[model samples]
Target chain A: MKILCNKADLLKGVSTVSKAVPSKTTMPILECILIDATSAVIKLTANDMDLGIQTEIKGTIVEKGMIAIDAKIFSEIVRKLPDSEISIETNDNLQTTITCEKAKFDLAGKSADEFSFLPKIEKDVSINISEFTLKEVIRQTLFSIADNETNKLMTGELFEFSGSTLRVVSLDGHRISIRKIELKEDVESKKLVVPGKTLSDITKIVSGEIDKDVVLSYTNNHIVFEFDNTTVVSRLIEGDYFKIDQMLSNDYETKVKINKREFLNSIDRATLFVKEGDKKPIILDIGEEAIELKIKSQIGSMDESINIEKEGKDLMIGFNPKFLIDALRVIDEDEVTLYLMNAKAPCFIKDEKENYIYLILPVNFNVGA
Target chain B: MKILCNKADLLKGVSTVSKAVPSKTTMPILECILIDATSAVIKLTANDMDLGIQTEIKGTIVEKGMIAIDAKIFSEIVRKLPDSEISIETNDNLQTTITCEKAKFDLAGKSADEFSFLPKIEKDVSINISEFTLKEVIRQTLFSIADNETNKLMTGELFEFSGSTLRVVSLDGHRISIRKIELKEDVESKKLVVPGKTLSDITKIVSGEIDKDVVLSYTNNHIVFEFDNTTVVSRLIEGDYFKIDQMLSNDYETKVKINKREFLNSIDRATLFVKEGDKKPIILDIGEEAIELKIKSQIGSMDESINIEKEGKDLMIGFNPKFLIDALRVIDEDEVTLYLMNAKAPCFIKDEKENYIYLILPVNFNVGA
Candidate 1:
C-alpha cells in the first residue's frame, strides 16, 4: 500500500501485529502481514488461525491499495531503519519498496487476497480497567498456568468476572496463583479461559499507563481485547474450572511474622543444600526469638537463622525451601506472616499488611514436637 | 581448609578457577576446585584434565589444610554473600562451613589430593608482551578458530613466537584471521597451539593497565600464561595446525576501500533476504561508484545499494554475507580494504593501515559469470 508513516509508529504497529504471525505455518500466507491504506489510516493485520492481532496507525494515503508482506522480515527491517519518515510504495506487480534515508528494502509481496481475515468479534462485553492493574494481575497469575497439553484446560488462565471485580486463577495442579483486581466498569458476570501465551503477548504491547479504557469482548468461541489502536483476539478453552475457594484455609494453630527480605534470604540459603530425592526437606526450627533454617543434602548442608518477633512453644517443621522462597518474593508487604496449621498441612502465607495470600501445598516432612 | 579471606578476593579466585570447571565431567573431581591453605597464601585450582586455572590470594590461615568443594555451589554462595570476611572452615570430618555475615553454607568436601596436578611449563623460550596488546591479538583472532571437534588440532589458535614478534593465526578452513604484535622482551623462536577457550577465558579475567606485561610460556603438552596473581594453563593441541598463511593471497588484483560502517551495514541488510539453497545467489554488483546488494529468497527478496569511492574496474563477487560481516567487525580501522584476486580465489579483507589480514573462502554461486 502506498502510504507515508513515521518509522516509530509503523514499528510499534508492526511489532504488535507480528506477535500473532505464524512462527511455522503450513499455509504460506499465514506468515504475511496485510497492510491496507484506508483514507488517512494504514491498517496492519496478522493472524495464525487461533490468535490474531490488528493495529492501525495514522498516515498519509497516497494510493489506496493493499499488499501482504512477510511479517518477521518487514518488522526486523523497520526496526533497524532510521527513525525518519518511511515511504512505502506498493505496485500491481506485487512488490513493496520501503525506503528510509540511505537504507531501502525491496521485499517481494504477496497478493492481498492471500491474507486471512481476522477473527470477527461478534459479541463485545466491554469492561474498563487500568492497563497497569490488568498487567499486574496477569503477570502474577498467568505464569502459574499449566504449559503441558495433557491438562488441556489448565493451559489457559481462568478469568472470573463478577460485579466490579476481576479475578484470575491459574494452577498447574502443583502451584496456584490467584489475583483479583477491582474493575472501573461493571459487566455481566462471565468466565473466560484464555491461553497463557496469547495473554502474555498482548501484555507486551500494552503500555503500563492506560492511554484509553480497554474494551473487552467475548464471542461464542473467542475473547477479544480492544485497546488504543490495536485489537487482539484469542481462543477460549471450554471446560468446567475447579472450585478454587474451597482450597483456602480459615484457621491456623501457629503464626510467625518476619521481615520478608530476611526470611527470603534465609530460605534461599537453605535451598542450596536441599538435594533431590527422599530426605531433602529443610527443617524450620522455631524458637521464642528466632527461626533457624537447615537443610542437609548428600553433598553437605546449609543453616541460616532470621530473627522473629514471636513467643510460642518451640516447634520444628520440615518443608521444601523453594516454596517459602517463592511465597516470600511475592509478598506485597515488608513483613510476611506465615500461618502454620501444625506445619503438616498446607501453610497459608501472606503479608501482614496486605490481603494477598499464597498457599503452599506442603510436602510430607517429619515434624518433631 | 580453615582460612579467613576477603570475600571479594575469595569470590574472584573461585570465579576465575571455575571458568575451567566443566559442568559435566566423566571424572567427578574435575567439577571441584582444590582449595589449598598455606601460611601466607591460599590457592584455588579447578581443572577438566585439558586445562587448569590457579589463583593465589592472601589470607589468614587459621589452620593449614587442603580440601575440595563443589565449584558451582561454592561460587553461588560466595557470590551472594555480603562483602565482608568469609571464613571457610573445614573440620576433621571434612565438612566445610562458609560463613559470611548472617549467611552460612555447609558443603560436603573431598580431599584435595584427588585433583590432577597443574600443567607445567617445559620450554624456556618465552615472550613478554603488554597485556593490552596480547589481549587485542587474542580477541581479533580467536573467533576464526574452528568450533567443530571434527579436527581437534584446528580448534585451537596457532601461535608463532619469534625473536621480536608474536603472531596469532586461527582458521575454520573457510575463514582465517591473523594478528601480529611486536614483543617487548626479546625471546627465542617458539610455537605453541593454545586452546581457544583458554585464551577467551583469560581475556575475561584480564586486568591491569596497558603498560603491564604478561609472561607466556609453553611446553610439549601445555601453554601457561602467568599474569598478576593468576596462572592459566591449557593443554596444547598435539600435531601441527593447518598452514593458514598459504590460504591468503600475497597480493591483490582488484582492491577497493570503503567506510567500515557503510560496508558492514550494507552487507547486513543484504543478509536479510539471502537464503542458502539450490536457488538464487546473493549478488554484490559493484559499479563505478556504488555497490548494489541483492538477495532473492523463496519467501521474498531484498535489494539495497551504497555508494563508495573506487579507482579500479567494476567487479561482482558472490560470497556469504556472514563471512564478510565477521571480517568487517574485527577491523579496528575506520576504512576497510577489500582485495579480490579472482572470483574463485579467496578474498582478503584488512584495514587500510593494519597488518591484520582476514581471508574468507568464496562460495560458488550458480549465477556464476
Candidate 2:
C-alpha cells in the first residue's frame, strides 16, 4: 500500500483515534492503531475491546492495502515531521515506511487481520440531536458517575429516550444529577446504559455547533455515534438501572432563591477548615433574609453568611460542600431555587423549566447543635 | 501575638518560605513554619535543618510574640482569605485566631522555640552580582548535576571565585557544563560546593532583573543570599568537586559553525525514535560544507543533512541527542561553534567570549558501517 498525506492532516487523524488505544494490555495488537487504505479515503481505527474510534484523513492514495502500527511511535513521528507532503508505503512483510522532507522512518507493523473490528449497527432506529445539546447534557451529569469499579451499574449513566425528549441520569449513592433535552425530531423510545468512559471520549470529538447534528444508532448490545468524518462504537452495559423517579419527590416545606455565585463562595470559604481525611459537614442555617454556613473541625471553625430570598418556613440542613459546589459550577443560571423538606430529608436544586435537577442527601447531624 | 496584615502580603510571605518545608520528615517541627510578630515587622520563617528561608510581611503589630504552624495549611488558608486586611492573634496556649472580612479560623499552633532557626553567617567573604546573571549561570549548568543519591560529590556544583571571576561547573559522569562571569570589583578568592537542590530553590526566589542585586555571603560552612525582602541560607557540601579543567582541551581536529535552531531541531527529530530503555545514538558526519545526522534503531532509521561551514579534517561522531539539546536550548547565541577531537573523545560547544562551555562524551559506533 502507498499513500501521500499532508503532515497536519495525518497528525490530527492519528491523535483523534489514539485516545481509544489501550495503554497496557496482554494482547500486543490492542496497543496498535489500524490503518486501512482499501478505499478512496484513508481511515485510522483504534479499539480497546469495549470502545472503538475511527477517523478519516484526507490524502492522495497510490495503492490499496491495510496494516497496524504502534500508535505511540507513529503519532510521535507524524507530529515531528516537516510541514510537507508525507509518503507512506507498506510491504507484504508488514514493514511500513514513512518519509517526509529529509526524514524517513521504517517501523515494524503487525498484520491487520489480528486486530478487532468495531461491530456494525443495524441502523433500524436512529435519532438526531444537536451537538451542542448533547455535549452540554453529558457535561452536566457525567461528574456524578461512580468511579469505584466495585459497583458496575453505578459506573454507567442511564439514557432514556421518549417522544422528542431525552433524559440522562447519573448517581453515585451520595448524590444524583439529571439533565433532559428535547431532540429535533420524534423517534422510537429506547433506553441504554453507557459507560462513563465512552461518554467522556464522545465529548472530546463533538464540536459545539448549533447546526451540526450527530446520528445516534443502537442495536441489541452496541451503540454508535457518527458525526463529521468520525465514528464511535461502544458496547452497552447489561444491567437494570435504579428507579430514580421513586426516590425523587416534589413535596417541600420551604423553598428559597439564592444567588449562585454568592452561595458557592460561602461554601468554598467554609470548606477551608476541612482536612484531607476529615468528612466535615457544612451546615446551612436559613432565616428570613439571610443564610449562614458554619463548619467545625478539629483544626479550626469557620462561618459565613449570604442574603437570600426566602419563602415558607425557614430550615437548616447539613451537606458535603464538594457535592454542592460540583453541581453549582455546571449550572448556567444566575439565580437557583433550592427545595428542602427538613434537615433529615434530601434537598433539590432545579431549574424553572425542569431541564436540570440535582438532589443531594443531607448528612446526619445533632439537631440541638 | 496580634497583627493586622494585608491578605496579599501575608500570602506572598508564607508561599515564599513554604518552599523549604520538608514534605515528609520524622520531626514534626520541620513541617511547620515559624511566625514571629516582634517589634515593627512581622516575619515568616521555615527551616528544614539543611536550608532555611525568611521573608517579611508589612503589618500593624498590637502585641509581640512568636508561634509555629503547619506550613502547608497556613499557606493554603492565606491564599483563600478574602481580599481585605487580615487580623491574626495568638493566645498563651499557642492557639492562633485569624480573621478576614466575614471569615474566621481558629487553628492549633506550637511555640516558635521548637523550630530550628537560621544559622548566623560570619561574612569573611562577600560578592555582589545581578540577579539575572546569577539566575542565568545556574540555569545553564544545573541540568548536568547527578540525580543519583550515591554520588554525593557529583550532586553538587563547584563555585570557584578567583581574581574577580566566578566559575560554576557541574558534571554527572557523562557530560560537564561550565558557566563563568567576571565581577565588577576584585575580592577575596573562595570556593564552595552548593547542592543542586539549594540552587533550584534559589532560582525560584530570585527574579530576573538587571538592576536588582543579590548580596551573597559565605562563612566556614554556609552561604547566605539576601535580595528583595527574602533571605535564603544554605549549608555547603563538605566535599571536593571533579577536576573538570583537566578533561577540557583547546585542541580539535575538526571545527564546525551551524545555526543553533537547525541543529537543535534535527537532533530533536532524530531522538523521537529512541524509546525509554533504548539508548539510540545520533551520528553526525561533519564535512567541509554540510553536516549529516543519522540514527538507526530496532524500529527504524532516519538521516538528514544540514548545511554548515566547517574547517579542518572531515570527521564523524555519535552522541546522546538529549545532552546536546539541553545545552543548545540554554544558549543565547544564534550560531554556535562545535569542536571535536575524534569519535571516542569528548566534544565542546562554546561561545566566542568563553563565558560558557559544554563538553559531551561521544558514544562509540562501528567505523566500517
Candidate 3:
C-alpha cells in the first residue's frame, strides 16, 4: 500500500480509530490497525471483538493494496513528525517505510488477511439526531450506569423510541437518570440496550456540532453510527432492561425551588466531613424559608443553611451526597425544582417541560444525632 | 484559643505548613498542625522529625492559647469555607469550633504539649540571595540527585561556599550537574549537603521574586531558610560528597556548536523508536557540517540529521538519550557548545561565562550496527 498525505490529516484519522484498540489481548493481531489504500481515500480500521471504528482521510493513492501495522508505534511516530507531507509505502514482504523531511522509519507489517473486519449491518431502520443533542443526552445519563457485570442489563443503557420522542435511561439499583428529546422525523418504534463502554467512546469522537447530524442504523444484534467520515459499529447487549416506571411517581407532598449553584456548593462542602468508604449520609431539614444541611463523622461535623422557595409541609431526609452532586453538575439551569412525596420515598428532580428526571433513594439515619 | 482571620490568609498558612506533615507515621501526633496563639501573632507549625515548617498569618487574637489539629481535615475545611472573616475558637476540653458566614464546623483537637516544635537556630553565619536565582539554580541541578538512599550523600546536593561564589552540585554516579553564582558579600567557607525533599518543598513555598531575598543559615547539623513570613528547618545529611572536579576537563579534540532547540527536537523524535526499560543508545555521527542521529531496536530503526558548526576531526559516539535530554532541557541558551575529547571520554556542555556546566558519560556501542 502506498499513500501520500498531510501529517495533521493522517494523525487525526489514526487517533479516531485508536479508541477501539485493545490495550492487552491474547491474539497479537488484534492490536494492529489495517491500512487500506485500494480506493481513492485512505482508510484505517481497528476492531476489538466488541467495538470497531473506521475512519477515512483524503490522500493520493499511488498503489492499490492493504497492510496492518502496530497502532501504538504508528500513532506515536506520526504525532512527532514534522508539519509536512508524509509518504507511507509497503513492500511485497510487508515491510512498511514512513518518511518525512529529514526523518525516516522502517517497521514490519503483518498480512491484512489475518485481521478481523467489522460485521456489516443491514441499514433497514435508521434515525437522525444532531451531534450536540446526542452527546448531551449520553453525558447526562451514562454516569448512573452500573460499572460491574453482576447485573448484565444494568451495565448498559436502554434506548427506547416511540412516536416522535427518544427516551434514554440508566440506573444502578440506587438511582435512575432519564432524559428525553424530540426527533426531527417520525420512525418505527424500537428498543435497544447499548453497552456503557461504547457510549463513552462515542462521546469522545463526536464534535458536538449543532448543525451536523449522526445517522444511527441498527439490526437485530448490531448498531452502526455514521458521522464525519467515521463509522462506529458495536454489539448490542441482549437482555431485558429493568421496568423503571413502577419505581417513579407523580404524587408529591412537598415542592421546593432553589438555586442550583447554592445547593450544589452546600452539599459539596458537607461531603468533606465524611470519611472515605463510610456511608455517612447528609441530612437535610426542609422548612418554610431554608434547608439545613448537616453531616457528622468520626473526624468532624458540618452544618450549613441555604434559602429556598418552598410550599409544603416541613420534612427531614438523608441521601448519599455523590448522587445529588452528580445530577446537579449536568444540569445547565440556574434554578431547579424538587418534588418529594415523603421521607421514605425517592426524591424527583426534573424540569417543568419533563425533559430530564433524576430519582434518588433516601437512606435511613438517626434524627437525634 | 480564639482568632479571626480571612479565609484566604488562613488557607495559605495551612497549606504552607501542611507540606511538612507526614502522610503516615507510627506516632499519630506527627500528622497534626499546632496552632499557637500565645503571642499576638497567630502561628502554624508542623514537624516530621526530619523537616519542620512554621508560618505566621495576620489575624486578630481575642484569647491567648494553643492546640493541635489534624492537618488533612483542617486544610480541607479551610479550603472550602466562605470567602469572608472566619472565627476559630476552642473550649477547655479541646473542642474547636470554626464559624464563617453561614457555615460552622466542630472538630476534636489534641493537646499542644504532645506536638513537636521546630528547634531554634542561632544566626551565627548567614547569606542573602535573591529568590529567583536560588530557585533557578535548584531547578537546574535537582534532577541529577539520586532518588534511592543507597548512597547517603548522592541523595542530597552539595552546597559549598568559598571566596565569593556559592556552588551547588549533584550526581548519581553516571553524570554530574554543577551550578555556580556570585554572592553579594563574601563570608566564611562552609559545606553542607541539603536533602532533596527539603529543597523541593522550599521551591513550592518561595515566590521566586527578583526583588526579594531569602536568608539561609546553617549550624553543625541543621540548615534554616527564612523568607517572607515563613521559616523552614531541615536536617543535613552527614557524609562526604563525591569528587567531581577530577571528572571535568578543559581539553577536547572535537568541538561543535548547534542550536539548542533544534538538537533537542531531533533527539526527542529519535526517542520514539526505543522501547521501555531498554538500554538502546542514540549514535551521533559528527561530520564537518551536520550531525546524523540513528537508533535501532527490536521493533524498528530511525535516522535523522541536524545541521551544526563543527571545528575538529570527525567522531562517532553513543549515549543514553535520557541523560542528554535532561541536560539540554535545563540549559536556557539559544546556542550551546559541546566539548568532546574522544569516543569514550565524557562530554562537557557549558557556556563561555562558566556559570553552569553539565558532564555526561558516553555509552559504548557496536560501531558496525
Candidate 4:
C-alpha cells in the first residue's frame, strides 16, 4: 500500500486509533493497527476484542493495498516527524517505509488479512446527542465507577433513556453519582451498561464543540459512537444494574443550601489533619443558619463554619472528606443544596432541577464527641 | 514554642527545610523539623545526618521555647491554612496547637532536646560567587554525575577554586561535563567534591538574581551555603575524584562548527528509529561543507545532512544519539565547535575560553559498513 499524507494528519489518525491498541496480549496481532488504503481515503483501525477505534486519514492515496504495523512504534515515529508531508509504502513482503522530510523509518509490518476487524452491528436503536452534553455527563459521573474488577457490573455506568430524557448513573459501594439530560428528539426506550473505561476514552475523542452532535447506536451486544471522522465500538456489559432508585429518597429531616466554593474549601482544609492510612471522619453540624465542619485525630483537630440557608430540623453527620470533596468539585453551580434524613442515613447533594444528584454514605461517629 | 507568623512565610520556611527531611529513615528524629524560638527571631531546622537546612521564620516570638514536629504533616497544614496570621503554641507536654482563622490543628510534638542539631563548623576557607553563576555551573555539569551507588566518588562533582577562577567537573563512565567561571574577588584555593544530591537541592533554594552573592565556607568535612536568610550544610564526599584532565585534549584531526539547535533536533528525530535494548549508533560523516547523520537499524534507516564549517580531513564517527543530545540541549550558544581526534577517540564540545567542556565517548561502529 502506498499513501502520501501530511505529518499532522497521520499523527492525529494514529493517535485516535491507538486508544484501542492493547499494550500486551496473548495475540500479538492485537498490538498492531490495520492500515487500509483501498477506499478514496486511508483508514486506520485498531481492535482489542472489547473495544475498537477507526479513523480516516486526510491525504492522497497512491495505490490500493493494506498492511498492519505496530501501533506504538508507528505512532511515536509519526508524532516526532517534522511537520511536513509523509509518504508510507508497504511492499508484498510486509515491509513498510515511512518517509517525512529528511527522516525515513523502514519498519517491519504484518499482513493485514491476518488481523481481526470490528464486528458489524446492525443499527437497531440510535440516539443523537451533542458531543458537549455527552462529554459533560460522562465526566460528571464516571469518577464514581468501581475500580475493582471483582464485580463486573460495578465497573460500568448505566445509561437509561425514557421518553425524551436520558439519565446516566455510576455508583461504587460508598457513593453514587447521577446526571440527567433532556434529549432533542424522542427515541425508543433503551438501557445499556458501558464500561467506565470506554466512556472515559470517548470523552477524549469528542470535540468540545457543542453544535456538533454525536450519533450513537446500540445493537444486541455492541454499541457504536460515530462523530466527525472517527467511530468507536465498545462491548456492552451484560448484567442487571443496581436498583439505584430505591437507594435515593426525598425524605429529609434537615436541608441546607450553602455556597459550593465555601463548602468545598472547608472540606479541603479539614483533610490537612488526615494522614495516609488515617481514616479520620469530618463531622458536619447543620444548624439554623450555618454548617460547622469538625475533624479530630491523633495528629490534630480542625473546625470551620460556613453560612447557609437552612430549612427543617438541625442534625449532625460525619463523612469521608475525600468523598465529599469529589462530589462537590464536579458541581458547576455556585450554590448547592444538601438533604439529610439523620446522622446515620445517606445525605444527598442535588441541583434545583434535579438534573444532577450525588449521594454519599456517612461514617458513624459519636455526636457528643 | 509560641510564635505568630504569616501563612505564606510559614509555608515557605517549612518547604525549604522539608527538603532535608528524609522520606524514610531509621532515625525517627530525622522526620521532624526543630522549631527554636529562643531568640528574638524564630528558627526552623531539619537534619538527616549528611545534610541540614536552617532558615529563619518571619514572625514574632511571643515566648521563648522549642519543639520538634513531623515535617510532612506540618508542611501540609501550613500550606492549606487560610491567608491570615497563624499562631503556634506548644505546652510543657510537647502537644502543639496551630491556629489559623477558624481552623486549628493540635499536633503531637517531640522534645527539641532529642532532635539532632547541625554541627557548628569553623570557617577555614571561604569563596564568594553570585548565586546565579553557582546555580548555572551546577546545572551545566550535574547531569554527568554517576547515578549508580557502586562508586561513591563518581557520584559527586569536583569543585576547584584557585585565584579568581572556579571550575566544576562531573564525569560518569560515558561522558564528562565541566564548567569554569571567573569570580569578581580573589579567594583562597580549595578543592571539594560535593555530592550530586546536594548540588541539585541547592539549585532549588538559590535564587537566580546575579546581583546577590552566596557566602560559601568549607570546614574539615562540611560545606555550607548561606544566602537569602537560608543556610544549607552538606557533608563533602571524602575520596579522590576521577582524573578527567588527561581525557580532554585540544589535538584533533577534525573540527567542525555547526548550529546547536539544528544538531540537537536532528539527533532527536534520529532516535525514533531506536528501541529499548537497541543501542543503534548514529554515524556522522564529516566533510568539507556539511555533516551527514545516518542511522541503520533492523526496523529502518534514517539519514540527514546539515550545513557546517569544517576545517579537517573527512572522517566518520558513531555515538549514542542520547548522550550527544543531552550535552547539546544544555548549551546556550547558537553555534558550537566540535573537536574530534579520530573515529575511536572521545569527541569534545567546548567554548573558545574553555568555560564549558563536554567530552562524549563514541560508540564502536563498523567504519566499512
For every model in order, the TM-score on chain A comes to 0.90, 0.97, 0.98, 0.97
Q: If both were scored by TM-score, which would come out higher, candidate 1 or candidate 2?
A: 2
Tens-place lDDT digits, model 3, residues A87-156: 9999999999999988888999999999998888889988999999999999999999999999988989
Task: Evaluate every candidate with DockQ and list the scores.
Answer: 0.51, 0.57, 0.77, 0.59
Fraction of true contacts retained by every candidate, in order, equals: 0.60, 0.63, 0.85, 0.65
Residues B269-293, model 3: lDDT tens digits: 8888877798899999999999999
The lDDT leader among the candidates is 3
Candidate 3 positional error at B325, Å:
1.0
Candidate 1: which stretches are off by over 4 Å?
A82-85, A100-108, A122-125, A185-189, A210-213, A217-221, A274-279, A311-315, A352-354, A366-369, B122-126, B208-211, B240-250, B275-281
Error at A160, model 2, angstroms: 1.9
Ranking by lDDT: 3, 4, 2, 1
| Tens digit of per-residue lDDT, candidate 4, span A262-342 | 899889988987886778889998889888899987767788888999999999889999999999999999999999998
Candidate 1 vs candidate 3: the DockQ winner is 3
Task: Give me the runs in candidate 2 sitting further than 4 Å from their true place.
Answer: A366-369, B366-369
lDDT score at residue A62, model 1, on the 0-100 scale: 88
| lDDT of each candidate versus the true structure | 0.79, 0.89, 0.92, 0.90
Q: Mind giving the per-residue lDDT tens digits that candidate 2 earns over A1-369?
A: 899999999998898898789888898898899989998899999999899999998998899988899998899888888899999999888889998876677888999999898777788977888888889999999999999988898999999999988999999999999998988888788889999999998998788698998889998798889898999999998888899999899999889899998888778877777777778889999999988888888767777777899988888889999999999999999999999999989999998788999999999766454
Candidate 3 clashing pairs, residues 3+ apart or interchain: none
Q: What is the interface RMSD of candidate 3, in Å?
A: 1.2
- lDDT score for candidate 2 against the true structure: 0.89
